[model samples]
Target: MDTLPDPVGSSQMDIETSQAGGTPEVANSAAKPRVRAPVRVEEAPKFDLDTYIANYTGRTRYDRLYLIGTCSPSLANEALKAAIAEAKASKDIIKYEKAVRALSEVAPSDPEATLNSAWVQETQRSVNAQTERLEGELKGYKNNLIKESIRMGTEDLGNHYYRTGDLAAASKAYSRVRDFCTTPNHITSMLFKMVSVSIERGDWLSVQSNVHRLRNSQSKPEDAARNEPKIAAAWALAQMQQGAFLEAANSFLAIPADLGDSYNEVLTPNDVAVYGGLCALASMNREELQRNVLDNQSFRNFLELEPHIRRAIAFFCNFKFRPCLDILESYRPDYLLDVHLQRFLPQLYKRIRTKSIEQYMIPYNRVTLDAMAKIFAPSVIGGEAKPTDISSPFVQELIGLIQDGVLDARIDMEKGLLISNQVDLRSEVQRSTLENFREFNQEAHWRILRAQVLYHGLEIKSDKKFGDGGKGARFSREGAGFD
Candidate 1:
């Protein structure tokens, strides 16, 4: 530019010269490239695993231990193998301890397994300590349940013994309950059972003592009342048996009105009639008997409606033959009269048929004869009355007429009519009429039939040969079976 020297030719010469030697631009470019602050690639601080592991010692110690072990499994396994080899090589305790310590230093890989192992050890220690406490509590609950069950069983056993009339057994059972009972109600119930057992055993002093205890004890009124009647009835019966009639009557009269009503309502007709009759007999008051009879609707209803029952009662109470015979004739019951009816009939017949009795007399069936012997034989005859005592004087008189062939003659002479025309004689037209009587008096028949009706009456039995032979003959032991 200074001389602008030959412009283009000068520039060409400079370029040629620069190319011959290293050009200034090439030399400058080669001068270390101006060292532009070496572009720093900052490689994220080389991922310092040691520092990470160290930081986690307290916070994630288990995690750090797992990571170290997993990352170097081969190294850790090799270390364990070497330790095991050393332990196997030498049995020295010191060597073993060293191997165990070294192996323990290699942390467990599973953090959860390590934590679980520690937790299990701690839980085992606590469980061992608490087991005794829990066992004691469990034993207490078991004992309570066992005691309750025993109480229930004892109560039931006492009740069973009482029903079966095993007073001693019942008392023992009740005593067991009382001994173990923890509750007042249980004690009271046991006391009541004791009292009832005493009454059934007829231990009057014990009954009185128990009753007094029951009165003093706090109990339900209904329960107390339920136990009182039987005791009172038993006491009254005992007094009556001892010939203390007035005292016994007073005792029976003292029975609560409600109790009497309950008895009347609950007892069967026969039971009510029998007990009412006993009460009347004890008091020796016809009015009381009538009142009891009327009060018991069953007895009154039967007497009013059942002619046979009425006939039985009439014969039993009045010993009147005409009324009873009239009632029996009117009813015409298929079955024969029971012993209570048969016993009075003889006396009734003698009193009513003294005049022209042969005409009015009816031949006695075997059933009638058996019943008569059972009912009245003891009282009238010196020997014990038996169901088979058909040989009484009154019965012999009737049987003699038939045996002597004078029944028809006597009937005709007394009534001035043919024997066929007489109502009383018409019933015995055939000897086979006695067959029903024989069957009715048979032991087997009475055992089955009377057992069905009375449930507990008539212990007689027809002889085995008679029953087996189909003869239908019956017989009974002598004396009153009650004694």
Candidate 2:
């Protein structure tokens, strides 16, 4: 995010968290509000639950499925069912219970929603026994003062804590392992734990910090290559979460290809494409979009996963604004269901639309309001639901953009056109020249004053006039002695 380097040949990347192993651990305690029937509604998300889930493995599968279930009522039953199956296969009873509870709310008749007390009890016992055993082993390692053993032991405990959904405990355990790390791999492993904890906890700042810590680590070249895509994706995720869209775009674009399914525990290649493409469209200009997006060889592989994003970018680059926007709108519902993207989707779309409008007017002195409305606000124009007038939403948006200095065009309601406030380059250059000359003259005067003072060996000294206790004495500089 900070560097926004080129996608290919960049050394920066991201990876590993509590679900750092075969299973991911998230905060099971943080309750979420349940969403009503998602698929049952007329506005169903176009996202395929099975296909999206296929991109991930380990604990993230359950985490994402649980999120989809809770948030999208249409997908709730299917998502929660898959989440339950994942939890059943794992020892995370807290997660199992949560999923079961949520499912019961959504589909009480579904047998999977019925919490299995026996499984919960058995898992609880297994977890307790494992925790005690790991704690004992960690104590023995600490007593022996074995750095590697202690580090491993701490990580085990941390992973266990993570699995049990003890987020605070897991974070603490992960942090402790850093003190005992003895190698680059060790440091990398420890940093991954920290990143995972922070990610699951929604501590984006901490996630970025850990990513930088690893990015700056002295890992072997081969290992760094293996982990680069994920860390970069993770960093970009943090950047996106923090509303640093353009910075996030650069980080996402910087992620190399050939990652395949290796980094899917947190993010899929499709995520990289979707996230990077949208952000680039929203932030980057046409030239940047062309060079960094459409022409980016490394990112091209990721773009292949979602050809729609590629088409959107191509459409945008080719000045086909309405088609580009239409494609995005068609996918909005599905994108809205994405856990990381939902919060920023509205902002991203708004930015893309405004930028398109801004770009559309760049070559023109003026455009008819009708033309602008059709391109930017087609739904609101000439519809009984929204009156076609100066007071309409499209006009309001234009007004806001104009007022905010984002658009250099203004509405000429009398003529029904948006007129560009074009600049006279000759006058602008003359004005710039005058300002520079004034600045130089002012600087020159100061320089002369300083030179004269220095030449005269100016020094401050108190000169007594005729006053008690030097009260009447004033400090004066021995100056150029001007007559």
Candidate 3:
């Protein structure tokens, strides 16, 4: 009756009212709430110090502060002190965090950075006390290793000295270590060191003794085999020094083939060439042996070990005149040259000159020229030339003055008298001259010819004739004259 005013609108209202309280429709029409799914987050990657330090460019203030803190303790402290002061001025969070991280990293190593003037002395005292306590705790452990390590340390020091060319120091240091070390490596090292020192000092017997010890030692099989060539070489040198060439040759031949290969591998090219030359000299038929050696790949490989030595060997082997001249001109007393000269000078001279006397004559001329050139320009030549300058300067000058007539008659006469006196007083003009010439030419009378030539040039012109018939004719015929 109350809703009779709008029956048209009331029809829809009556339908809603009838449905509002109905149990079956209300329960069925209830709305359901939506729920969200769980979110997934990834963890950050691990930090690496080397990478961080490597790429640390100071773009931001924090980055700049981090860089200063990580480099060194003193730098970190200085940066942190300034940063703390600046932080107090502005109360910046970034500045404060940077300062705190820096202080934490550097505080253990550098107390001064963390402690201001007000607390500096106390902090230092605390650090010193802590350091002393830690050091005291570690001392007992350190002392235990010292005695056991001393010999090894000293031996290593000796090897370092030897490598650096301080042979005398190395010898002494090695000797000291040798006395303390009894192990197989130590004994072998000591023997090798002694042998090296003896070789350098030219003590053949000592080298032999050390080489024997090295051979007999309880060294590793490889090391023992590796030492064979050196031992054999040393033994050969000792026998040679004792004037036993055949024995030396036998000793040299006793060296294993593999030992030579090992020696070649370890030695410098120059050393290989020198040793090969020595080994070649030890053979009964050196030319044939050398040909064989040169043809062998192993020996050629040895020659390839050092450019300088290889060049020298090639020059010597091929008889390359220019290379030999260059080597002589350069004036190094190389071991290869020494050994070759000792072993093959007679053969080389005969092959080149085709006469024994001419072979003798060549070295006489070489010695005279060398002595004269050395006196005229001392710095131009070295080794034997330098010593010859010291030993024969007056003789050289007398020859020069006499030949040139540069000195007055009185001075010339005096120089002549002085030469005659030297010849008389020392008997060295005859003896040493002969000995040096023989050593140079490997001939007995090489110096006698040299001296005769020197006297003839000094006393008489080549074209001049001097004689009182038969008596003077005897002297002239004998290639002796007085003007």
Candidate 4:
């Protein structure tokens, strides 16, 4: 929570001060930075490049690989080369050119960086020929006035446009298929194509809109069973992008682990595990984590694929803060390189860290600043305590927690301690009671006054005596809130 210039290390504390007992007092928070391990951006993630890439297909593969190529310095050249190869294999000249540009930026000496005008010209000619052919076919089908033939023609054209990376044209072509759709499956297929287009375009709201349409479509039980996992993953991705971590976790948790690579074009079981698990950690309580994640039999299969994430949840549930946090820290770099996770990582990690701080303080009513610092903001060298001074990041975090009401605790600066405050129930009740009585008295007076006005039938006429002609109005007890 502290905006320190130094790289963020895994340290969290919530500080407030108490003059006598548990009452909070505001104090200026300052933090002194102690050395912590600078995050190693070059650290390669646990998975191998080829194996990981093989888990996905379609544009997602390029997006993910390119993201890694751009974000992870250690994997840049390999990822960029892989991306270029994949792009070149596709009919999409746009994809190929984009990948070539990235490779040129990262590894100019690499052969893939070359524009390869020969391949470009060939793809250009092919794309033009294919587009004209598909368009001509669609025109013929339309002239025949056959709905099914028209639908087929439109879908073929959409597929052509998609392959050529003309997403706008592809999306329009796919949408055209909808009007010609004669059955549930046709509509479903059209919707799916639109979803893919929306996802590639980073249009999350469209993804959600189409997923909603898909869910409500007339799919049979078997179809639902086969498609539910894909739908859930897509919906979860949209929710994640929308910043609804808890809702996204619930959606992800609902995904059946048997999904395997069925949704590999957009997501994988490993992704389900990582995205769902991190979202859970950021938003769910220990009990919730246990119930929805560690104990959910249906999702256990996905968890098995990413055991590190499972262990992180387990550690957090067990209140093993240090190890839990360390695990998250180690994996942060990998998640940072993820296409979908990169933008949301800051918010997700912040929530997880803040929640960890809250959980750590749950069992303590009074704890020393040294003790808090040892667990949070520890010196990376020997796990030493950070300075309890106002300048300490640890102290600053505590200051934030106090101000934000995330922690009901106070700091005793001279004593170098955190003193927790329990809500004074008696005071709170008395305050509420006093406020309620005042409201009741005011209501009773207004009602009695109204009764007098009604009894006397005093229909006061508007007069200039009122500063604003319409300002002074009589109570119509009928329109009053209490009424």
Candidate 5:
């Protein structure tokens, strides 16, 4: 194998030539470099929202903590404990203070109990120290810086106090920031917070004023969208408190569900059902209930939450008197607990019952006293026949409905029957048309007579007052009057 190689394929010659710093002959074809495959990144382990939110701290944690605490007390307590521990371990005074106040909201107890807790006591000490340091820093600043500091400090204090459920203190603090807001959005946000606190305190006048500010503020599109739901809900709440049911119902119905769900902390879907249903029942007519309430798809969704309310409305729409009243009567205890509804429950019930009675009588030419009693009388298990006399309360109620024009029918006391007062439209129209024709004929006859007399060169004379002097006037067919 040690024979001499070909000159063109001389491997030894090439090796020797490369060693002697001479270029070697190379093949024209070359292999391509291999491409390494891209590394695959595994998807981040599924995020746990509960665990993620537990890390939230600062003043923003108050509302989130409330929601979590209500839904899962143990998780909220764990999160609170972790925050408190971290705050103390790191010596973060603000975190420790907010965490303690948030604890008070989650599990409210006696003042002494909260004050006696070691963590709360430590938070209080930190708060005092911070306040002293802040005051010391305030004294060294110029007037402008001092005013700016005070303004920022007041707003921060207001937010802190609001989170701690001290509405009065929060309101005072917020009031001091009014003169310092530089932008329209800042002013609007401040007023909105003020309105919220005023609602909590039931100060309707203040709420009205602040809500007015929010409405009149020049807000950008995003800001307006963010604030509209709150404005509508607050206005509706005020209207509800004032017993303006129709206004409240309309307002509540106008809110989008996505936005309205945010107010579940204040008003539940069940409350919406009660408020909207009762208001509509009290104010709307049978046709209106059928058109605006029962048939309205959006409102129907809310009514679906309370089946009995939906059923009651359905019964009323179908003119079923006993069942509608029965449904309302059965749920009377539930409605009584609602502070706003309780005040007007009796009146609303009376109105609904009266409307049902009116509807029941609509198709009848004359209904017997027994039939009226059978419908309006309280429920009986065995369906016993109750002989209702002409003097029964139901009869008097019908008479009242008649008087109120809620029912176009009258009670015949002697005959023991309800007589419908509904007029036949065809007959009424024919009679009216005939009367109009007769009047037109009489006027034409008089005009023809006057025209014939005028054609013969005669003028019509009347002794009626033409002016203040009560002078008589003569008239020709063309209505030319000469006094």
Candidate 6:
């Protein structure tokens, strides 16, 4: 077997011998192939590209790019290629810029090689210029690089914009936040945000739609506790906007104090008070107001936000007509200017006034006109208030209510009193029963008489026809043969 020459020591000795003037050609011939020691380069730990990118939330996009570009040229190339492919597929200029920048950093030119360092720098500069040109496109893409984070972050940013009153921009930003929410709470939160935006834009239909979503979602207990009041408030506001006062009032009253206290963005506590109080006054009876509004602990908590409204409701429920009207009158300006309450104010006040009249007269057989006027009239606050007379608008309104059957009483102008139209239940029932019985008896007598007439008429006709000479009549009675 042929052996290989020693390349290390022999090559050095041949150089020494040739320098020492020994025959140069013989020294060179005597030199063996140098066997160099094996190189031991410490390889860097390989980066798992899939694992790194999979966990990447675009927050660290630039950082990751720097790490790959500086530490691992191969991984940088892989990242760049992946980014390029994504950019092309998605038509994202930001990703394209990222790819260019990464490539320039990863592959710098070597001067000793055919491609000089200056050429490399020039190429890098060109890539950088292109990247800078596309940098403006990168502003929104950072969040979007990671799907989940983007959705939530976009929602937060949308809310910020909404709060700042950039409504159009806010809506546009929110539209980009797709509802990829995983939990019920998250879904409800998304819906609430949408509702808030709708409310801002006065898009009541959209608000109601989102409110429906919030209502149907089954949130966690904590989330429900946190979110239910806001949802209720939004629903009530939307209903009020639509002039569905009855439903809106119920929704407002349903909001728990804790939630109501926490949520003031859409409806203040005072607004809730006026809304619920007025709605109850308009649609519900005194009994309902007592039961559903004044007596309800949760709803009362909300009303406590505006104590006067609560007082008004209590007064109305307790049949203090004058006091209730006074309290409502005091808040007239506030209610008049309220976005939700203003539209309903006049109707609501009228209902309260009518109810006051009805309830005031409920137990009385007769009330003086002066007394009725005193209860129904809005009293002047500061000066000596005039005694409201029968000819006043207050009395006129009461008269109208009575005529409309809203108040089941009659005003006697000559007697100068309000007379309650009381019907005796027992007497009415007995009279109705007696009338029915008499009608039934007459009907039975008529039926009997008509039957008798029909029977007699038939009998007479038969006798006349069957007088002994009538053959047709004679053949029918006995079992005789027809001749």
Question: Quick one: best lDDT, which candidate?
Answer: 2
Candidate 2 C-alpha lDDT tens digits along 231-275: 888899999889988998999889989767777767888888999
| Tens digit per residue, CA lDDT, model 5, 219-303 | 8888887877667777776777777777877876665444545554345555677778887887777788788778777777778
> TM-score of each candidate?
0.28, 0.78, 0.31, 0.78, 0.57, 0.54
Query: lDDT for every model?
Result: 0.40, 0.78, 0.44, 0.77, 0.60, 0.59
lDDT of 4 by residue, 66-178 (tens): 67776677888898788777767776555565566656776789887888999877877877788789899999999999999999999998887776566667888899898
In model 4, state the lDDT of residue 390.
Answer: 79
Report the poorest 10 consecutive residues by lDDT, candidate 3: 1-10
Error of 1 at 265 (Å): 16
Residues 249-291, candidate 1: write the lDDT tens digits. 4565454433333322122233223333333333433334445
The whole-model C-alpha lDDT of candidate 2 against the native structure comes to 0.78
- Candidate 1, which segments miss by more than 4 Å at Cα? 1-167, 179-188, 195-217, 222-269, 287-483
lDDT digits (tens) for residues 1-483 of candidate 6: 112112111333444555788542223322222322212112332336665455333212332332343334345456555545443343322223334544554453522112234543454455445434433333455535755666666666555444323345456666666455667766776776777666645678988888787777888787776777777788888887787878987888887677634554556666677787788787777788889998899887767767888888788777787888887776675454343454467777877777777788777778887666556653522222443445566667777887788887877877778887887566788999999999999888867766776667532333556665776554331123111
Runs in model 5 lying further than 4 Å from the true structure:
1-152, 163-165, 294-301, 304-308, 362-365, 380-387, 390-410, 420-427, 433-483
Alpha-carbon runs more than 4 Å astray in model 2: 1-42, 385-387, 424-483
| Residue lDDT tens for model 3, 125-187 | 543454355445435434665644666666665554443223455576677776667678778
Local error of candidate 3 at residue 403 (angstroms)? 32
Please give the clash total of every predicted structure, in order. Answer: 2, 14, 1, 15, 0, 4
lDDT of 6: 0.59
RMSD to true structure for each model, in Å: 48.9, 12.4, 35.2, 17.0, 27.3, 30.3
Ranking by lDDT: 2, 4, 5, 6, 3, 1
